[model samples]
Target: MNVVLFNPRAQKAHRRLPLSLLMLARVLDCEWALVDGNVEPGAEQRLDALCARPGTVLLVTVMPGPQLGVATPSCRRLKARYPGLTIVWGGYFATVYPEAAARDPGVDFVVLGQGERTLPELLDALRAGGDPTAVPGVAAWRDGGLVRGPTRASVRPADFPDPPYERLDMERYAARTFLGDRTYNHHASAGCPYFCNFCAVVNMFEGKWIPDPADHVVRIVRRLATEYRADAIEFHDNNFFAWEKRVVEVSRGITDLGVSWWGEARIDTMLGFSGATWEAMARSGLRMVFFGAESGDQDAIDGMEKGGLTVEDTRALNRLARRHGIRPEFSFVLANPGDPERDVERSLALVRDLKADNPDCEIILYMYTPVPLPGMYDEATKQGFALPKTIDDWLSPEWAGYDRRRNPRTPWITPGLVDSVYDFETVLHARYPTVSDLRMGPWQRRALRALSAARWRLGWMKAPYELRLLQKAWGYRRPEEMGF
Candidate 1:
């Protein structure tokens, strides 16, 4: 049996090694081949060629929304071309919407939640000619309906195999760096502890915050630094500071390695970290930190169920991080459902204040995208928002909030209002793109700010992608530089 895994090509500066797929490969008992759709343009053709010499060929894919749109059609085409191929779907989208995913005849099985334990067992069953229905954390069609197996228990990082970095082409993957060099991405924890309504991380992990043992994290960091000569590390955890002790231990261990690192943490969570811990982390080479501030207004924050986090907390954290010599990146969502124009202004006000306080601070603005997970998706439909009806709709860049340039997922907000906010955001990015830009002459900065204001005042504009190439030709910059 040929076990193949794929990484869907994404349009980002960094190509993340499909860490989950590599880990699954570590525990599997059969010979496996890893395929990167990003590096291999003719991935489908390669799969087709493999099927010619195979007995039972299993093609497993883990994808998010945009990739799913591309993969679903590709899978359908492959199934039609070769009937013997076994197709499996996993990852955030499939775990949240198994029934919808399995409805596509091309997908023979849906691996729910975590795949480390369930995937190997499913493969074993297939190899032994036994019923795969007994395998937990799996969803498949039976009697013309979706049948989901028992939910598998979530595992901490210690339970999984060490990340199979050997499976990826390390030289081909590079993360865009803001302060330091691009580094290898790793996670010290699993699942976010927060219950923000817009979050899909918690839902996918079954609402558990699991961290790898401190020793396990230290060992991995040391190996990456000594063996791979990694100059930096990106902790891809949803919230790296979820456990204070774990943060202290991991930071202290990596301190001697002298590798600058980055990670995301909530403002509310960071408030609890002692000054000593923050100082320790700084000495450990924590150069950059990302915060999902979500919104500036307390009301908007409450609306998202992002418990008790306020604009004040964001302000304090920005100041504190700056004091510690750690560059802070704050992200905000504009025009969320149930939020009014005044709320949008409040978020803008917060951004202006933060920039004034710390000109070097990175501010990210996003349109509130409606993700179709259990809690948030239920709320969206209840509020009369239409969910994607077919696989193609799910794949369409216009429908998914993550990829859409013009569509606003928050139906409650008018299109004109959304456009206005985005226009203001364009101005914001134009003026304060990065920390280094702070060194620009005051006159040059003021001129760009005036231009941004003029652009917004020019009225409703098409989405960025619609005008990206023209803007690029105008010598402003490319859409990719804008973090598209």
Candidate 2:
């Protein structure tokens, strides 16, 4: 069997490792080829040469928003050209909308959540000229109907083979970031324990969480540090700090490696960490952390079932991170269903308070785009919102921005509200340019800060044309736009 895994163009010249495809490659029993559009020029042309064979399987890892738009047409043309080729779609986009993905002309098979198990099974069936749709966690349009197997969720990363990083040019993925000169990304964990109803992780993991053992994680990090000369690492796990013991162990192992690192965590969970754990994290060179501080209202947070996180908890976590000298970047889901106005008002207020409490804390404001789940999505439905049922519909101008998390096209959120959020974000970022933006000079930073100081302090987030002009002129990179 000829299996070629393709990572569609996601970011612009961003050197991100495709850990998803690498994981699948590790477990594949047959020979396979890998092409990353992020790094490879003429990625589709390479696929064309590799996929011209009679029994070729073109596996693609797709994300929800922009990547889906990118991969759809590419795969469609590939399929149209080589009608004998088999195209399989995997990753968050396929897992979230398996049936819809199956209905697409390009996607022949949709691999649900964890592909380590299901993908091999589906391949075994396909190799035997058997029914691929019969495999568990596989979905396909067959015999004029959509056939879907049982739903799949999270699994242990340790149970699988290590990511086959040796297959690719490690130097291609070694990009410089705020953490250090050369940075590489790793997903050490599989899922999140808590199910934030609006989160796609909850839908993929079903409230289950799993992480590779501390020793395994440290081994990989050690290799990246020693062999690849990576001075920093980013743990792209859904929840990197899911288990504190493993975190401490990993931290202890990496303490002497001298590699700066970053990860994501929950506000309430980290607040419960002992001082010893906090110290270990700091000594490990943990520089920054991301948190889903979903809302500013305690009641609203409680509604999201974020493990009893209060409005005060975000503030407390900010202080904790500050004490540890680790910057905390909070992502807020604004203009949520029902009472969208109140949601925006309270969340933006909290953003201001957070900045005041800790100058280093970063605020990422996102419009609430619901996953196809219960709770908030039901509310979104009540307020006239629905997920696109086809690939083309998802590419439409209104829905294309859906996964960017800034401009949600839900009816409850007016254009004024979206602009208000953008305006405030512009002023806020101008006042405090992101440290992730290393290209920004001291003069430009001082100028932006001075110009936006009055607007930020006076709560004047209207238009802010001056800030926009400077940001456009200087090519300022907001942390949100940069995907930090």
Candidate 3:
């Protein structure tokens, strides 16, 4: 029997470590092949070769956007060619919407939540001719309906084995970004602790966070620096700063390694970190942090249950990050379901304020996309927002765009309003081109800033055709899209 691990291609410049597959590889007590679609030119060919034998299991990690688009077609083609092939879908999409994958004729099983413990058991059941869905965190198609096992939180990261870096081509995973030429990625923590209603994490993890100890994180960092010569590390955790002491310890231990790091943290949580902790973070080369200043309105923040985060917290963090020389990349969700236009205007005003407070600060603007949880999702459902019933429907252009949060066409937001939000973003990008684009040099940066200066100042952001053309010519990528 042959086992293969697959990560569907996300997009260009989106190559990072396939952490999900690596974690599963460490625990799977069998010979397996790992193929990363992002780096492997012959990913499908390699998968076909591995999955030729009888009882071959192909495990795929899929996200909601571009990855789903590619994986859907690939799985359909493979299933049609090999009747004995077993396809299993995991990752964010599978956990959040298991029926979408389980209902698909190509996918035989769906792994929910975490897979370090569940996947091996499911494979054993399949080999023994037993019920695969009996394994916790496994979902499968039985008869004509979907049979889902019990959902649970992720297991402890400490119990997992060391990263299986030897199994992968580290040079391919190493990426060029604002941090360094050879930036790599790691997920040191389990799910996030807070339950932001609009966030997809809630649907899967239900507000639980488990992190590896500080010493363990230090060991990994040292190994990456000494063995792989990695100059930077990006923590792909849902929230890396959940435990203050762990972050402080990790920061101090990694200081001498000279590796710049970045991670996501809640504004309210980081604002509570002591001055000493901030000093430790700065000394350890904490280059940047991503915060979900979700909305400019305090009411919306409260409604979303962001763990008591306030609009003022966002402002204070911007100042604090400036003081520590750590750049703040703030992402705002524009156009709330209720009063979409007003929500956007308030957020735009806050964006201006954030830029004024810290000119070097980065801003990411995303249209509001509802997850399957309460609060906003209920509002969305009332406004005719519904999940697709079949995998093919998810591959449609509108649903694909919805997954990316760039073009979600919620009924609440009007076409005119969407255009206005995008126009504002275009001007914002022109005036403050992201520093992440290593190719944009001094003169190019100056030209962009100068060209969009008048429109930004006069608040005339409508129809900035010149700015759009120049951006396209330069091939600019926004900070949000760059995984900042």
Candidate 4:
């Protein structure tokens, strides 16, 4: 069977291949055509021209935000051109909200949960000219009615197929960097054991943390380096350090290969690992590491149910990573339930201190958007933050019919304010120069002020997206110097 997998773009094309489609192709054992939905302006026309082929089944993968707008229209056009083709939709968005996606006229089937086994089974049934109505994990329309199948079981990371890189556009991605120079993506483990109130990982993976064998993961990394020439890899595992022995083995294997990679690790894991282990990871080409330091305030951290690491533990983790010559990046959540002004001030102070004390430490702040999956939204609403009427409202403007709802409990700041603060932080970091003394040089400070003045003069300060696009375009033109 000929299967065409589409990746709809809400932003510029990133190098990572959609792992789900790769698993699907392996399961079906079919010839696949992969297309980037973000082509130059008339690229969709070119896509339509290519998709108008005989005996092809179109499977478009979509994410929740802006990508849905692109995917829905593209699917509609593809179905209009080839009425006999089977069009299926799956991804984060479809899995979370299958009912809304099933309502779309262009979607023939919506596969929920893990698609590894279910997708192949659906394709097999189609090949046998069997009815799709009874297919598990698939939602289909039959006889003018919607039929929802039973939920499918989740598959382990070890069970997924090796991603089909040969079938994808490698040249376009080769020009891009993975986390600023890394080039591979891997999931050594599947699922997150922690039920972070605002996370979708637990919901998607059903709170199951299954780690793949160490040797199997190492073999995959070896292939990525030898075949793909990937200098670095990003372990996409939700909690990569959940299994210590597996991490140590994988680290040793990659170190043996002389390839560098980075991944998410918990603070406790870093502290648990002896200094020698961190040294081994550094020797193995692990350049960057990310820790989920949700907040510096212990109370806010407790409120979010993230009690794994205290502020001191996080500081120690940062010091350990720096001591190993590894760059540590902190992933933090800005606001949480019952958080006060003092909490925000304390968090910012911690960030400032980290920057001052550890030059290699980088801070990434993410807003605590309440997802309706399980704990987060209900808790936030109970704390008196008004949620949007539906889940779709939380999506960004580029997505179709997205409505940004205001939170009554957190009336001190608006969602727009949070976005702007992040944007400003990016601009500030980009325009300013880092000094060994942990102070911006005079010229750097002047440049930042000048840039701020220019932005204000042109009314760009209020337009975060526009300012970001300009910055990105500028960065792309001189990527070698951009450090990204």
Q: Which ten residues in a row have the lowest lDDT in candidate 2?
A: 475-484
Could you give candidate 3's per-residue lDDT for residues 1-484 as a string of tens digits?
5789998888667588888889998988878999888889998898888888788899999998888888998898889999999999999999888888898988999999889989889989988999888888999878878898787557877688987999788888788888988898888888898888889988778888989999999999898988999999999888999999999999999999999999999998999999999999999999999999988887777767788898899999999999999999898887777677777888899999999999988898888888889898888899787888788899886687888797777778888988998999999999999988776778878999999999999999999999999888877888867742
**Cα RMSD, each candidate:** 3.9, 1.3, 1.3, 5.8
TM-scores for the candidates? 0.88, 0.98, 0.98, 0.80
lDDT, residue 349, model 1: 80
Q: Write the per-residue lDDT of candidate 1 for residues 1-484, one digit (tens) a residue.
A: 7877765654444455567677677777777777777666687677667655545555556455557766777778777777878888888778766767888877889898778889888988888987776899988878878887788977776686787777666766554454345467787777877777777676677568888988899899898888777778888788888888888999999999988898888888888899999999999999878898878778878877786888889999988888888888888876766655867778888888887788768876776766665554576688888766556667666666653423556557787787767666556655554543323345654555565554444533345442333234443432233222
In model 3, the worst 10-residue window by lDDT is 475-484
In model 4, which runs have C-alpha deviations exceeding 4 angstroms? 10-14, 38-46, 49-55, 128-133, 140-147, 175-182, 340-342, 382-420, 423-484
Ranking by TM-score: 3, 2, 1, 4
The per-model lDDT (C-alpha) reads 0.72, 0.88, 0.88, 0.66
Would you give me the overall lDDT of model 4?
0.66
- lDDT for 14 in candidate 3 is 54
- Tell me the spans in candidate 1 whose CA falls farther than 4 Å from its real position: 174-176, 372-379, 397-406, 435-471, 474-484
lDDT of 3: 0.88
Expressed as tens digits, the lDDT of each residue in 1-484 for candidate 4 is 7788777765553446556566666666777766665434566765676577777778878776557767877888788878877889987777767666776668888887777778878888889988765788888766656687777767776876666677666544442343334365777777777777666675577677878898899888888778777676778787887876777788887786766677887787678987677777788888777788878788877666664568888888888788888888787776665654555557766876676668567666655666655555676666676643332453434323321112223534456555554554555344322221123346544655466556543434455564355445434222112121
The total of clashing pairs for model 2 equals: 0
